[model samples]
Target: MKQVQKIKLGISIGDLNGIGSEIVLKTFDDSRMLDFCTPVIFASAKIITFLKKQYKLSLNFQGIDDPSKAIDGKINVMNVWKENVNINFGEEDPEVGKYAFLSLEAATAALKNDDIDVLVTAPINKSSIQSENFNFPGHTDYLARELEGESLMFMITDTLKIGLLTDHVALKDIASVITPELIQKKIDIIHETLKQDFRIQKPKIAVLGINPHSGDNGVIGKEDEEILKPTLHKIREKGKLVYGPYSADSFFGSKNYKNFDAVVASYHDQGLIPFKTLSFGNGVNFTAGLNKVRTSPDHGTAFEIAGTNSANINSFKEAVFKAIEIYKCRKEYRKLTQNALKKQGRKDTNKKLFTKDN
Candidate 1:
């Protein structure tokens, strides 16, 4: 088999009224993006044209319906929306939601069919893109369904990384969702990603407790002791390096996070609060344990700053770069894994031959 020389990225243009277009334009500003990998965008030709004039960012687009046919040195646009898109500038529109879903659909299809290697997405407006827009709660749920894989909402920075057990779900629904099976699944996903996509040989993972003081020996909450202990036991039995159920309040202060590679939170707020506090606009949202590589910026669609040249492109750049990094890691892992399989195969063949001769 021929080794892949170039990484392919499918870009989704999020809500047009927000800063999605601007970030997309800014991320493509470095022509080096082409040198690193191939870029295919899923959006409208008219929308990108309008964005060029609005942001004064000079970028040429090559129209292609499929990601497999994308060409290098130009933005390959998969135009799912043909109508002239009207941008209300900062105003949210239901049309924006419709178009965002269309773009996501196209991007996702490409990912499943092996047409694209990495899916680097821009921000979107969840509210406007709802039933009034698309009826989906968030990208994590939608993509999880489409990919038919359990999903994880993880935020990463140079300093720290957080994986939320539950994301975008209501607080009321969160406790119900925090089951051992799901927690074990999330931890396994994070561990595998760290090894295969992050090149960590033995990843140290820290699991956060659910309640304050980690349920205070069931005084504060029994969920941590009853629910979490068994799960940790199972994970440890698998020969994985992990420790936790520590007090959520004291875990951050102990500076023990540095001892681990990734932190697993019991809920969304439990993990994200400290993660955003530390990383903020600098963090990159990474979906862990998926067969395909997916990444996005930590921040949301900054509609107010759209086209004002005030939106920060740092997070967008981080997403793009992280996607590339993960791609490389996957490639190296495949190579190593293939070599190991071949080596084992050769040994088996030699053993069989020796036995037959004897």
Candidate 2:
């Protein structure tokens, strides 16, 4: 019998002026969480102490200089910075944003170095976090650049999974951005992700139309009928369980999304709006198709409820759980595939030997 190794969960503290710290502390407050994974928070010990006292949380943490020094069965806070900073609950500050980037950068580096098994990022203030160094629209873009593989913003829950074809793009530009190539790429990514990450033997994917009523058969818009339909047809020809060009307006309301394993939305709000609406507190935003596992809460920084001690921690907790689960699933999927390949190789070699004898 062998003992299972616990996952090293790396956490990046988000905007200080928002509810990121509050929800993080509250989620780990339950001591039972420590049994599952070793949590390493990439922020200063001083900041963690400040947040704990500010929120009056009884959560205890071990301060360390590096993620490798993190101890299992204890909350570990790696001191990414040693300076003491100001704490304002609801105000947006550039200074606070700098520390958020620093935390994320360090945590990401640890993830790349294999020091952490997975990463669960807290919400960051997109506007304030903008700098010359960190110029991406959000985490998905940043992670896609930092890590390998084509990234898809896959929002997941117990039953629903939605992937965006064009995230962080202007609504006006979505039409132009969603070409046949982009559509094929996203569908391929989603199809592989469902099989590899979610462990679905054969995946059923539905693609939402670019226009209302899927261009109403070329009445509302031409993109859905001309672009989406044709590309999806090509994919379906490849023996993939891909369906749709379904009208976005009536897709979810008619409960049509339930029939498929995942839905591909044309743009950001098209997917996220409905996902957040139905699975707000439970959904985990997973960066599928990445070499490293990364997930985040479905919701963003609740700036209004910053230090009110009223922020919901369910989404953050789910993010952590999803990250760990996906890591295990990926490892198992790789092992199974490798074994299958080796067995096939042996069979081929035996067949060649028989042919030679004959």
Candidate 3:
């Protein structure tokens, strides 16, 4: 039997005070995961040791100084910093935030340099992880800046996929940001990402309306008719399969989302509220349209449950697996596209040569 290539998964530990280390350690506890991919965590070995002793969870992982030396049989911790930052499990501290940034920065650099095939990020406190160097809203924005591409916040699960037209923005400002141009741009990215990243040949997407009842056909708001409706029409006219300005209220309740490959919400809550309610503990927040692959658990830092050792590792594990799946899908997609292009070039050359001879 031919051996399958194992991908190297780079993990960025979120706020050390939170469940980042716990979830990471739990997800890697099972030795079966190592058969699929090699996990390289960008965190201090001391933190892992402390967490292991605290939780009394028996898991074996090796600490490596370099990512290239990461072995397939063990979860390798690549030290980002040697300092012993204090971990106040439930309290937010500046030092913890500093280490979080350092881990993320190092892991992101490794991803860009192709040292790792994919990145599985633990939850980071948006408020705490702020500093002079990290001033963005969250991971998506920070990664977008580093990777130099438009970021599409895609929430994924086994049953459903949702993409936000506007991510991490104020609800009051949503109306202004939901312009036809922005909708079109996000739809284009979602369409392409679905085809390439998820391996969907012809993806069907549904777009939710900005207002309730889809503006009641312009009774409540005109954004749906004036902006979204026309944009969806334009997108469909371009040979892309996209539909609706559907009412956010009834769309999911009526199970209309089951008919499409993905749903695009006009703002964050419109998409995420229902998403979390449906798959809170298992959904993976994938940052689409970036040159690099990054996936994070849909839930937040869970500060209240930080040191209790009760945090669910399901979401984090799903994030890791999802990243690997997307990575492999993208690789295969690239190969297929490149081969098709080469074959087309050969046909074009033959046509030109035959024309000249005739």
Candidate 4:
């Protein structure tokens, strides 16, 4: 196969009523986004025109019927929605949800078929997206289903990378899912992904306990002592640098989380609460183990400020940058591995030739 020149990124323009369209326009409006990848937006041309006229965002749009028609240095809009629906800025109509779902579905098809290198999804409103077919909480659950259940959600920043064992579940049911096997699996996924995607070797990981004081050895909660602790031990035995059962209360104190590369929390809040606290409005949520790469801005669809041109595009920018970073990381690692193999092959050939001559 020939090496592709440009990195093709399939961008889903999320709920039209939300700020998804605005941020996406702002993100691609700058010429810098084209420097890294060819962005193909799966959205409507009429909506793009509406946002440009309403918010006065400086964006040039060229509509394309095929992903292959996307051009560099310009925003490409692929109208997955054949008919244009009346868009109400900041209003949650079911039309926005339907279009958002179609945009996402189109993007996913392109991604699954290797038509795009990565997917940068804009925000989707959960309440409005309640059709019989569109019942996901957000992209994480939806992508998980489409990818056939092989993925994990992690909120990431330069400091404090967090992995959630359970997401968007009721707090009461969190403990039931906190088992040693699951943590081991999550850690394994985190470890392998960091190596493959982030190029981290011998990643040092920290695991958070389910209970305060880490159950204080069953005084507070037995899940920590019975389940979490055993998992940490078994992981350590496998020559992995895994630690903790540390109370989440003091874990973020004094910036101690920086000592480890990544941390695993038993539930949603335990991990994300700290992650969002530090990186709000600028965080990138990465789905760590998907066969097809997926990422989104950490913040939600800001419906209140949807098309006012008031929404900050920082998180979306960060998401695109991270996708590029991970792509380069994967590429470099493969190059290094190939080079090493080639060198080793030369060394083996020299040894065999010397032995035969003797």
- Give each model's whole-structure lDDT: 0.83, 0.93, 0.91, 0.84
**Pairs with backbone N, CA or C atoms under 3 Å apart (clashes), candidate 3:** none
* RMSD (CA, Å), each prediction: 2.4, 1.0, 1.3, 2.8
Instruction: Give me the candidate number with maximum lDDT.
Output: 2
Give the local distance difference test score of model 1.
Answer: 0.83
Can you give the TM-score per candidate against the true fold? 0.93, 0.98, 0.97, 0.92
Ranking by TM-score: 2, 3, 1, 4
Residue-by-residue lDDT tens digits, candidate 1, 12-130: 98888888878888778778777887888899777778788888877777788667888766778887878887788688888777888889888999999989888988888988777
Deviating ranges (above 4 Å) for candidate 3: 1-5
Candidate 1's displacement at residue 35, Å, is 2.1
Q: For residues 42-67, could you state the per-residue lDDT of candidate 4 as single tens digits?
A: 98787778778887767788988888
Off by over 4 Å in 4: 1-4, 338-358
**Candidate 1: where are CA atoms >4 Å away?**
1-5, 131-135, 352-358
TM-score, cand. 4 vs. native: 0.92
Which candidate has the top score in TM-score? 2
Better of 1 and 3 by TM-score: 3
